[model samples]
Target chain A: MELLSNLALGFGVASSLTNLGFCLIGVLLGTLIGVLPGIGATATIAMLLPITFQLEPVSSLIMLAGIYYGAQYGGSTTAILINMPGESSSAVTAIDGYQMARQGRAGTALATAALGSFFAGSVATFLVALFAPPLTAVALKFGAAEYFSLMVMGLVMSVALAHGSVLKALAMVVLGLLLGMVGTDVYTGAPRFTMGITQFADGLNFVAVAVGVFGIAEILRNLENEHDRQVMTKNISRLFPNRDEFRQMVAPILRGTGIGSVLGILPGGGAILASFASYTVEKKLSKHPEEFGKGALAGVAGPESANNAGAQTSFIPLLTLGIPANPVMALMIGAMIIQGIVPGPNVVSEQPELFWGIIASMWIGNLMLVVLNLPLIGLWVKLLTVPYYVLFPIIMAMCSIGVYSVNSNTYDLFAVAGFGLLGYVLSKLRCEPAPLLLGFVLGPLLEENLRRAMILSRGDPTTFVTRPISATLLVLSLAILVLVFLPQIRKRRDEVFTESDA
Target chain B: MSTKPKDGTDIAAGLLFMAIAGFFAWQGLGLDMGTSTRMGPGYFPMVLSGLLFILGAVILFKAFGRPDDEPMGRIAWRGILFILPAPIFFGLTVRGLGFVPALFVTTLIASQASLRMRPLAALVLSVVVTIMSTLIFSYGLGLPFRRFGPWLPL
Candidate 1:
C-alpha cells in the first residue's frame, strides 16, 4: 500500500502538463544528439544545463533525465544503422547492430534494440523505486569520516578502473583536487590560487569547464582524422524481428537486464561494463559464437537492454548518496545544487515528490521513446547524414551562449579555452577524465569531511581508520587497487578496454 | 611489475605533474599551514600537494622502465585554430555587435574547421543560423541578449 501510494503521488506529479511537455522535449533532444555521432549526452546536458536554469527544478530534471535515456536509445539506433555510436556506452550495440544492418536486417536490429531497451527501462525504473529508499536510509547513517572514506574509495576505484597508467590518473585526480581548491577557503576565507581575480574567488565556473573539456575538446578530437562516414541504407526493411529471432533474444535481454541492474549501482562505467559483459556472456553461451560479430540477434538485444538498464539505475547513486558515478551524474548534481536542493540522502526524506516523480517520469519517457522511435527510425537515420561541419558550429555557438549566460560574465567564456586545452592534452596522453571529474566534484567535500572528522576526534590522525565504516571503505579501496593492478587482471582489463574502445 | 620506460610522453607528463606539485606545495607553505587540530587554509592543500608530489615521483621513476612506447597523437590544429577563436570572437563582439552578428561571425569562423565547406555555402548557413538563433534565444525565449550590437549599422 505504501509503495502504491507513493507511485500514485509520483504519477500525479509526473503526469502534469508542464512535466510531460518538458519530458517529451528532453527525450526528443536527447535522441537527436544520440543519433548524431560525436556529440555526447554529457556535453549536451552541460550546454542545456544553463538553459534549464530558467525552468522549475522538477521540469528541468525531468527533461534532463529524459535526455539521458533518449540519448541511450538514439545511440543504439545509430549503432545499428550506420555503425556509429553517438556515445561511448553504445559501442557494444554497434558491434553487432552494424552487422545486422549490413545484412539488410537493419529494421530488425532497430526493433530489437528499442524493445530490449523499453523492457530494461521498465524494469530498472521499478528497481529504482524499490531500492532507492533503503539505500538513502543506509546513506543517512553515514558520518563525516565515513563519507570522506567513501569518497576516497570512489576516487581510488575510479583511478583503478580508468584506462592507461594508474599514475597518470592519480595525478589528474590530485590536479583536479588542487584546482577545486581555488575558491576562498571556508574556514579562514583566504583565497588559494585566485591570483586576485574576483571570479576565481567564487570558484571556476563548472559549466564553462565541463563544456570545454567534454564538448569542445571532443570536437577537436573528431576533427583529427575527420573520416568520411557513409550510411549504408536509409530505409528500414522491416520493423519487427521474426518469431525465431525474437525467441532467441528473450533470454539475453533478461540476462542483460539482470547484469545491468546489479552493476549499475557501482561507480564508473556500469552501463558500459554491463553491455560488454552481456555481449561476452551471450557470445560464450551461443552454440555458434562465430555469429556474434556477424549479426546475432541476441548480440543486439543483450547489450542494448543491458546499457539501457545500466543507464536508468545509475541514477541510484546520485539520488540516494549524492555521489556521482560519472561525469554526466556530476552535472546532475551541479544542476540539483543550482536549484537550491542539496543532493544526498536527505533529498528523498525531504523531497519525496522529486524523487518519485523523476522515477515515474523515467518510465513514461521510456514508453514514449518506444512509441516515438519505431516509426521514426528513418528520420534518425537521415539525421545521421548531417555533416559534422554544420553540427559542430551550432554546438559551439550553443556552448558559448550557455557558458556566458551563467554569470553574464565573459570571463567564463575565456575559461573554456583553458579547460578545453587541458582536456585535449589529457585525452591525448590517454588519460581518462572521469577520475579528474570525480576528484573535482568530491574534492571540497572530502576536505571538509576530513577536517570535521579530525576536529571531532581531537585531530587524531588515526580517526579515519578508527571509525569502523571508514576503515572498511579504506580497506575496500586498497583491495580494489591491489586486485586491479594484478598482472592477469590488468591484462584482461586492458583487453576489455581496447575491445570496447569507449 | 615490469619496470621499463613506457614512452617519452609519460616522462613529459610526469615532469609536468612534478612542476605543478612543487608550485602548489610552495604556495601552501606561503599560506602558512597550521597544526592538524586547528588547520589553516594551507594545511589540506599541503597534504594533497605532498601526495601529488609522491605520485609525480612514482611516474618519473617509472619513466626509466619496460616497453609500451607510442608517439603522442596529433593536436588537430585545425580545430584548435577555429574553435579557440570562435569563442573569443563571440565574447569580444557579443556585447558590441549583438548576439546575431557575433553568433553569425563565430559560427562562420568555426565552420571553416571542416575542409568540406564552401564560403558561399557557409555564408548562407551562417545567415540562417543567426536568424534562427536570434528568433529562438532572444525573441521567443526572451533571453535578455541584444540582437544587434551598437557597432552594426541598422
Candidate 2:
C-alpha cells in the first residue's frame, strides 16, 4: 500500500506542468548536444549544471534525469546517420545502423532505434520503481565499515572497467582522491592544501573541476581534429518498420532490456557495458551472424534498447545509495549537494516525493524522447553542421560563466582553466577522467568512513575483514581487481572496446 | 615524416603521477601524521601517497614491456594553443570588460583554433553568440551579472 501511494505521489508530482516543461526542455537540449559529435551527455550535463540552481530541486532533478536518458536515445541517431557516435554507448549502433542507412533504409533504422529504446526505457523505469526501495532498505543497514568497504569496491570496479590501462586508471583514482583532499580537513579543522587562499578553504569547486575536465577538455579534444564529419540525412525510404523487421526486433529488444536492467545495477557497469553486452549477445544469438555489420535490424534494436534501459536504471545507485557509479552520476551528486540534499539511503524515506517524482518523470521523459526525436530527426541532423569553430567559443564562455556562478567568484574560473589543461594532458597520456571524478566524489566519504570505523574499532585495520558485509564487499573488490589483471579477461575487455570502435 | 616514440605517452603519464605523489608525500611529512587510533589530517594522505607512488612506478615498468603501444598519433597543437588561452583571457577580462565584451574577445581568440573558419564568418559568429548569451543568460535567466562594464554606456 505504501509503495502504491509512493508511485501515486510520484505520478502526481511528475505530471505537474512545470516539471513536464523542464523535462521537455532537458530532453530537447540533451538531444541537440547528443546529435553533435565530441559533445557527450557528460559534458552537456556539466555545461548546463548552472541552470539547475535556478529551478526547484525536484524539477531540476527531473530535467537532469531527462537529459541523461534522452542523450542515450539521441546518441543512436547520429551513430546511425553519420557513422559517428555522439556518445560511447551508441558506438555499436553505427556498425549496423550506418550500413542500413547507406542502403537507403535510414528511416527504418531510425524507427527501429526509437521504438526499441522506448520499449526498453518503459520496462527499465518500472524495474527501477520496483527495485529501488528494496535496494535502499538494504543500504540503510550499512555502517561506517561497510560503507568504506563498499566505496573501495566501487572505486576498484571503476578501475577494472575503465578504458585504457588498469594501472593508469588506478593512478587517476589516487590523484582524484588527493585532489579531493585539497580543502580544509574535516577532523582537524586545519586547511590542508589551501595555501592560505580563502577560496581553497571551501575546496576546489566541483562545478569548476567537472566543467573543466569534461566540458573544456572535450572542446579542446574535438577542435584538435578540425575535419568536418559527413552527415547523411536524406534519401530515407519507409519510415516505419515492415512486418518482418518488427518481428525480428522483438526478441533482441526484450533480451536487451533484461541484460541492461541487470548490468545497470552493478558498480562501474552502466549504459556503455549494457549496450556492448547486448550487442555481443544478440550477435551470438542471431542465425546469420554475418548480417551483424551489414544492416542487421536486430543489431540496431538490441544495443539501442539496452543503452536506454541501462541509462534509466543507472540512476538506481545514485538515488538509493548516494554513490555515483560514473562521472555523469558524480555531477548529479554535485547538483544534489547544491540543492541541500545529501544523496544516500535515507533520501527515499526523507524525500519520497523528490525521489518518486524523478522516477515517474523518467518514464515521461522516454515517451517525450520517442515523440520528439522521431519527427525532429532532420532538425537534429542540421544542428550537427553548425561547425565546431563557431560552437566552441560559446561553450568556452558559458563554461567560465557557469563556473563563476557556482560561487560568484573569478578564482574558480582559474581553477577551471587549470583543470582543463590537466584534463587535456592526462587524456593525451591515455588516462580516462571518469575514474578520477568518481574517486574525487567518493574521496571525502571514503576518508570519513575510514576515520569513523577506525575510531570505533580502536585502530584495528582487521575490522574491515571481520565485519560480514564489509568483508564481502572488500573480497568482491579484490576479486574484480584480480580478474581485470588476468590476461584472458583483459584481452576480452580490449576486444569489447575495439569492437565498439569497429 | 618523423617517427613517433612508442609508449611515450605511458612513460610521461607515469612520471607525472609520481611527481604528484612526491608532492603529496612531502606535504604529508609536514603534517602531524598521528597514529592509526587517532589519525591526523596527513596520516591517510601519506599512506595514499606511498601507494600511488608505487602504482606509478609499476605503470612505468609496464610501459617498458608494452613499448609498442599505438604511436601517440596526431597532436592537436593548434587546439592546444587557442583553446587554453580563451578561458584564461575571459577570467582576466570578465570583471573589467563585462560578460559580452569578455565573451566576444574569447570567442574571437578561440575561433582561430579552427583552420577552416574565415575571419568574416568568425566575426559574425561572435556577434550572434554575444547577443544570444546576453539575452538568454543575463536577461532571460536572470543571472545576476552586469551586461556591460562600467566604462560602457548602460
Candidate 3:
C-alpha cells in the first residue's frame, strides 16, 4: 500500500505538464548527441548538463535522468545500424546487431533492443522503488568509518573493472584524487593547489573538467582518423518482431534483467559489466551457441536488456547512499550538488518528491524511448551521415557555452583547455579515464570521511576494522584487489576485455 | 638498443605519473602536514602523491622485458593546436567581445581542427551556430549575457 501511494505521488509529480515537457526535451536532445559518432552517453550528458541547470531541481533532475536513458537507447541504434557502438556497454550489441543489419534485419535488431530495454527498464524501475527505501534506512545508520570503507571499496571496484593494467588504473585513481584536492581545504580555509589563482580557490570547475576530459578528449580522438562511417540504413525491412523472434528474446530478456538488477547495485562500472556478462551468459546457454556473433537475436536482446536494467538500477546506490555506480552517475551526483541537494540518505527523507519523481520519470522516459524512437529511426540514420568535422565544431561551441554559463568564470574555460590536453595525453598513454573521473567525484567525500572517522576514533587506525560494516567492506576490497592480481584471473580478465574490444 | 624489449607506452606513462607526483609533493610541502587524526590541508594529498610515485615506479619497473610493444597510435596534433585553444580564446575574449562574437570566433577556430573543413564552410557553419546559440541560450533561456559588450563600439 505504501509503495502504491509513493508511486502515485511520484507519478503526480512526474506527469505534470512542465515536468513531462522537460523530460521529453531531455530525451530528444540526449538521443541526438548520442546518435552522433564518437560521443558516448557520458560526454553527451556532460555537454548537455548545463542546459538542465536553469530549470527547477525536480524538473532538471528528471530531465537529466531522461537524457541518460535516451542516450543509451540512441547508442543501441548506432550499434545496430553502423556496427560502431557509441559506448562500451553497447559494444556487445554491435556484434550481433550489426550482423542482423547486414542480413536485412536491422529493424528487427533495433526493435529487439528497444523492447528488451523497455521491459528491463520497467522491472528495474520497480526494483529501485522497492529496494531504495530500505537501503536508505540502512545507509542512514552508517558512520564515518563505514562510509570511508565503502568508498574505498568503490574505488577498488572501479580499478578492478577498468580495462588494461591494474597499476595504470590505480595510478589514475590517485591522480584523480589529487585533482579533486585542488580546491580549498574543506576543514580549513587554506587553498591547497590554487597556485595563488584566487579564482580557483573553489577548486576546478566540475563541469569544465567533465567536458574537457570526456567530451573534448573524445573529439580529439575522433580527429585522429578521418574516415567515413558505414551506415546500414537501407535494409531496415520490418519494425516489429515476428512470433519466433519474440519467443527467442523472452528468456534472455528475463535472464538479462535479473543479472543486471543484481550487478547494477554494485558500485564501479556495473552497467558495462552487466552487458558483457549477459552476452557471455546468453552464449553459454544457447542451444546453438554457434549462432552468437552471427546475428543471433538473443545476442541483441540479452545485452540490451541487461544494460538497460543495469543503467536503471545503478540509480539505487545514488538514491540511497549518495554513491555513484559509474561515471555517468557521478555526473548525476555533480548535478545534484549543483542543485544544492546533498547526495545521501537524507535526500530520500528530505526530498521525497525529487527522489520519487526521478523514479517515476525513468519508466516514463523508457516508454517515450520505445514510442518515439522507433518512428524516428530514419532521422537518426540520416544524422549518422553528417560529417564528423561539422559536428565537432558544434560540440565544441556547446561545450564552451555550457561550461562558461555554469559560473560565468573565465578561469573555468581555461581549465577546460588544460584538462582537455591532459586527458588526451593520458588516453594516448593507454590510461583509462573512467577510474580517474570516479575518483575525482568521490575524492572530497573520501577525504572528509577518513578524517572524520580518524578524529572520532582518536587517531586509532584500527577503528575501521573494529566497525563491522567497515571491516566487511575493506575485506571485500582486499579480496577484489587480490583477485585482479592473480595471474590466471588477470589473463582471463584481459581476454574478457579483448573480446569486448573486438 | 637495450637487450630486452620494453612496453614504451607504460614507460612513458610511468614517467609522467612520477613527474606529476613530484610536482604535487613539492607543492604539498608548503601546506601543513598535520597529525594523522587531525589532518591538515596537505596530509591526504601528500599520501596520494607518494602512492602515485610508487605506482608509477612499479609500472616503470614492470615495463622492461615485456614481449611486445603497444604502439601509441597517431596523435591529434591538429586537434590539439586548434581545438584546445578555442576555449581559451573564448575565455580571453568573451567579456570584451561579448557572447555572440566570442562564440562565433570560437566555433570558427574549432572548425579548423579538421583537415576536411574548408574556410568558407567553416565561416558559414560558425554564423549558423552563433545565431542559433544566441537565440537558444541568450534569448530563449534568458541568460544574462550581453550580445555585445561595452568594448564593442556598437
Candidate 4:
C-alpha cells in the first residue's frame, strides 16, 4: 500500500513535461550512441555530466539514468546487425545475434532483445524498490572497519574477475589504487601528487580518464582497422517472434533476470559480466548445449535480459549505499553529488520524492526505449550504411568537442591523446581496463574508510577482520582469488582467451 | 613450422615504465610527506611512486618470461599522425580561432586519417561537421562559441 502511494507520488514527479522531455532526449541520444560503435554510455554520460550542473537534481538524475539503460537497448542493435558489440555487455549478444542476422532472422533477434530488456528492466526496478530500503538499513549498520573491508573485498574480486594473467590484473589494480591517491589528502590539508601544478591539486578527474580511455581510445582503434569494415546488411523479415521463439525464451529470461539482479549488487559486477554469465549459464543448463553459438534465441534472450537487468540493478548500490557499482554508476554518483544530495541511508528518509521519483522514472524510460527502438530499427540499420571514413571523423570530432566542453580547456585534449595511447597499449597487452576503472572509482572511498577505521581503532588493523560481516566478505574475496588461480580455472581461462582469436 | 624472431616490444614497454617509475621516485626525494596526522603534500605521490616501482618490476619480470613474436607492424603510423596533432591544434586555436574553427580544423585533419575517404569527401565532411557542430553546440545548446579575433565588431 505504501509502495503504491509512493509510486503514485513518483509518477507525479516523473510525468512532468520537463522531466519527460529530458527522459526522451536521454533515451534517444543513448540509442544513437549505442548504435554507433566506439561511443559508449560511460563516455556519453561523462561528456554530459558537466551539462547537468544546470539542471534540477531529479531531472538530471532522470536523464542520466535514462541514458544508462537506453545504451543497453541500443547496444544490441549493432551486435545483431553488424556482428559488433557497442559496449562490452552486448558482446555476448553478438554471438547468436549476428548469426541470426546472417540467417535473415534479424527482426526476430532485435525484437527478442528489446522485449527481453524491457521485461528484465521492469523486474529489476520492482526488485530495487522492494529491496533497496532494507538494504540501506543494513548498510547503515556498517562502521569504518566494515566499509574498509568491503572495499578490500571489492578490489580483490575485481582482480580475480579480470581476464588475463592474475599477476597483471593485480598489478593494474594496485596501479589504479596508486592513481587514486594522486590528489590532495582529504584528512589533511596537504597537497599530494600535485607536482606543483594547480590542476593536479584535484588529481586526475575520473570522468576525463574514463572518457579518454573508453571513448577516444575506441575511435583510435576503429581507425586502425580501416580495411575490415563491415556494415550490417540483413533484410528485416518478422518483427514479432512466433510462439515457439517465445516459449524458448521464457526460461532464459527468468534465469537471466535472477542472475543479473544478484550479480549487479556487487561492486565490480556490471552488465558485461551479467550478460556473459547468463549466456554461459544458459548453455550449461540447455539440453542441447551444442546449439549455443549457432543462432540460438536463448543466446540473444539470456544475455540481453541479463545485461539490462544488471544495468538497472546496479543503481541499487549507488542509490542505497552511495557507492557506484561501475563507471556509469560512478557518473551517476557524481551527478548526485553535484545535485547536493548525499546518496545513502538518509536519501530515502530525507528525500523520498527524489528517490521514488527516480525509481518510477526508470519504468517509464524502459517503456520509452522499447517503443523508440522498435520503429527506429530500420533507421539505425540505415545509419550503418554511412561509410566509416565519414562516420569516424564525426565521432572523433564529438570526442574532441565533448572533452573540450567539460573544462573548456585544451590541456584535457592532451590528456585525451595521452590516455588514447595508453588505451591502445593496454589493449595490445591483453590487460582489461575495466578493473583499473573499478580501482579508480573505489580508491578514494577505500582510503577515506581506511583512515577512518584506523582512527577509530587507534591504529589497529585487526578491526577489519574483527567484524563478522567484514570478515565474511574478506573470506569470500580470498576464496574467489584462490578459485581463479586454480589450475583447472587457469585452463578454462586459456580456452576463453584462445576462442576470442578463433 | 619456421622459427620466429623474438619480439622485444614487451621488453621495451616494460623498460619504459621502469624509467618513468624511477624518475617519479627520484622526484619524490625532494618533497616532504609528513606524518599520518598532519599529512604532507608529498604523501600520496610518494606512495604512488613506490607502487609504480613495484609495478615496473612486475612488468619487467613478465616481459622477460614471455616468448616474443614479431612486432605488430610499424606502430600504426597513420593513427599516430592522426592523434598527435590534436592537442597542439586545440591549444593554439581554442582561444584564438574560437571553438568552432578550432573544432572544425581539428576534425578536418583528424578525418583525413581515415583510410576510407577520398580527398573530395573529406573536404565536404569537414564543412558539414563544422557547420553542424556550430549549430548544435553553440546555437542549440547555448554554449558560448567565441568568434575569431580578439574583439568583435557588431
Best model number under DockQ: 3
Order the candidates by TM-score, highest first — what do you get? 3, 2, 1, 4
DockQ scores of all models, one per candidate = 0.65, 0.68, 0.90, 0.43
Number of clashes found in candidate 3: 0
lDDT of 3 by residue, A310-401 (tens): 99999999999999999999999989998899999999889999999999999999999999999999999999999999999998999999
Q: What is the TM-score of chain A alone in each candidate?
A: 0.97, 0.98, 0.99, 0.95
Interface RMSD measured for model 3 = 0.7
List clashing residue pairs in candidate 2.
none
Better candidate by TM-score, 2 or 3: 3
Off by over 4 Å in 2: B1-6, B151-154
Model 2, C-alpha of A104: deviation from truth (Å): 1.7
Question: How accurately is candidate 1 docked according to DockQ?
Answer: 0.65
Model 3 / residue A20 / CA error / Å: 0.5
Candidate 2 residue-wise lDDT, B43-153, digit = tens:
888888988899888877767645556665667788778877887887778877788898888888888888888999989988988898888889988898876777566
lDDT string, candidate 1, A80-152, tens digits = 7778788778888888888888888889999999999999999999999999999998999998899988888
Query: Which stretches in model 4 have alpha-carbon errors above 4 Å?
Result: A497-502, B1-20, B30-48, B68-74, B149-154
- Candidate 1 Cα deviation (angstroms), residue B2: 21
Write candidate 3's Cα lDDT for B1-154 as tens digits: 8777888899999999999999999999999989998999999999999999999999999998894456988999999999999999999889999999999999999999999999999999999999999999999998878899878999
Docking class of 1: medium
